[model samples]
Target chain A: MRTVDPAKREAKRLQILAAAARCFARKGFGQTRTADICAEAGMSPGNLFYYFGSKQDIFAAVVEQDGVDTEALFAGLSAAEPWDALTRFFDLVVDLAADADYARLALEISAQAHRDERIAALVAANDRSVRSGLADLVARATGAGRIDPGLDPTTTATWLATLVDGLFNRVAVDAGFAPERERESLHLILARLLRHEAQPES
Target chain B: MRTVDPAKREAKRLQILAAAARCFARKGFGQTRTADICAEAGMSPGNLFYYFGSKQDIFAAVVEQDGVDTEALFAGLSAAEPWDALTRFFDLVVDLAADADYARLALEISAQAHRDERIAALVAANDRSVRSGLADLVARATGAGRIDPGLDPTTTATWLATLVDGLFNRVAVDAGFAPERERESLHLILARLLRHEAQPES
Candidate 1:
């Protein structure tokens, strides 16, 4: 038997996922074939099957990877000042919304989540993870007098998450949305929503 | 020769559309069969086909009817005081969002819009109609000094529409999100966004 390197195997798996993401984004999950993913990944069908048992498995992995990425992002932000961290979070959302492929993939996953119970569970878990992270930041900001103390942290966080969801949907729907151009309005809306008084330095 | 009464014909068409709406909302567009719609409408396949050429035509009509309903709604609200009309608009959104079937159907349509250019064009046209109505309200309010003069009506209207889109999405994704319960918060957020200082008449 040939010796298998775990790290190399993991890398190969990630390569497949990245390719799958592109294919799913371009064609949506139902229309995308595993062969398409293999071609995108520059691998044979056998090699692709060795990593993911089926297309469904590959799609699930893609959504699971989003949860992992979200957690990692929040963990990094948790150490920063709460207000700054929240600001950074919205800025990051704008960046993600600006990426057409990422926005389309997010919409595709959300659409699939509606029809598939397993996918819904995964999406709900990912949503919870995001909302929990946001709630923590909201709590910290309120406690530090950086935001309105009267606001419920969890509800505020959920709305914040909803705003990001809407942003992604706008990118997919509106041809002229221009996420980057809307950054100022987004910041202003956030400040108003949170009752934050911070002004950008001149 | 058999005669078709225009009024009766229109009524039957609406009945079919309403039934189709329920089926699409429950099973989504792809899974919903014309047989299911015919059964739901209490008609035979021949009767259903007489009204609609195919399932695709029926779906298109369903979406087009939504645009018609939306236009009629805005036309009714257009005469009200701008700010009051805007407030009523959000209130109606809460009502629609509270309807599980309506919210789900909206999501299904949006998902389909992503895959079909024709559907996308219809959805986009509906969206533009909505945003234009909202911008008109915003402009009137600004002129009347009911909202912040600094805010561009078109952009403000777009964000307001975005917020409502987010609201519908929240209902779909978050089982705990109660649209009726969130009314006050939504009002507060809108007031703050528009810099309106009006308080509810106590």
Candidate 2:
């Protein structure tokens, strides 16, 4: 019997997903063939299937990986103050947006979601994860009297999530938009939206 | 000498673009064939080519049409108070978002822009027009003392544009998000972001 190292197998799966992201971003979801992904990942076609069943499966994995990343992001912020946690999350968003391929891949995934039910559901789950995360923070902040009570937590979180989604779209759509410079204004907008006093941008 | 009726030509062009939009939204830009657009438009393939040289050309026209629509939208809003104009513009956005095909087509166009330079330039132009319209309103509002003075008009406009971009994306990505119901929260978010009093959701 051949023994497969579980950790090694998992790492290889991540490696394929990373390569697939690049292919999808450059050629779009429909234009990219499975062979292109295998080529990008520097693996044989047989090796690629060992990790993902097909192209659709790989795409779903990418979408799920995004969900996992969001969960990890929120998990790390669990101990921080609600408002500060949000601040850190937005900061991380800017950091992620700094990578053009990641931002482009996000845009591609959104387009795919529009066409595929499975992707749409996956993206929806990721969005729900984000909104729920924001909602939790908003509830905590409102309870602690850190922000305004004029809006409910879920709605506020939804709109905040909208801003985050829009931030990524802006990065993909506007070449001239520099995410680093917008960080200050993003802070200002979030502060105002939450009705909390904002620390002046540095 | 052969001559064409300009008005009729324009009408047919619009007809073809609308059909193309439907096909692109349904199948995505890459997967959509010219014949599909022709069938959707209810015209012969030759007639379709008379209006647009290639699939790429028709896509560009669709993008340009979006810019024209934006310009028309802002021009129509010219007489209103700056803040009211901004608010009304967002309301119009929500109204448009109610159209699923239009929203999906927008996602397709944004995805196309990421892959094609021609589309990118056109999309950027549309984005700039939106930002400028919002900036013009923001500048006037600040001048009229209608909002906070902490942020510049351009930056405020950019973020506001980001929110608009994000709103469309939310519609595309989140099935449960109803644009009609979001009006009140959107207004509230805008009010908070701009430091204006929010009108209660009706």
Q: Can you write out model 1's per-residue Cα lDDT over A35-106, one digit (the tens) per residue? A: 899999999999899889999999999999999999999999988999899999999989988998898888
Model 2: per-residue Cα lDDT over A1-202, one tens digit each: 8587999998999999999999998999888999999999999999898878999999999999999999999999999988788889999999888888988998899999988999999999999999999999899888877777756898888888888888888987788899988787777677677754521121
Query: B101, model 1: CA deviation in Å?
Result: 1.8
What are the clash counts of all predictions, listed in order? 0, 0
lDDT of 2 at A123: 96
Question: After aligning candidate 2 to the native by TM-score, how far in Å is the CA of B69 from where it should be?
Answer: 0.7
Model 2 misplacement above 4 A: A196-202, B196-202
Candidates in order have lDDT scores of: 0.86, 0.87
Top candidate when judged by lDDT against the true structure: 2
Model 2, position B89: C-alpha lDDT score? 96
**TM-score of chain A, cand. 2:** 0.94
Could you tell me which 10 consecutive residues in candidate 1 chain B have the lowest summed lDDT?
A: B193-202
DockQ of 2: 0.48
The residue pairs that clash in candidate 1, if any, are none
Residue A155, model 1, lDDT: 82
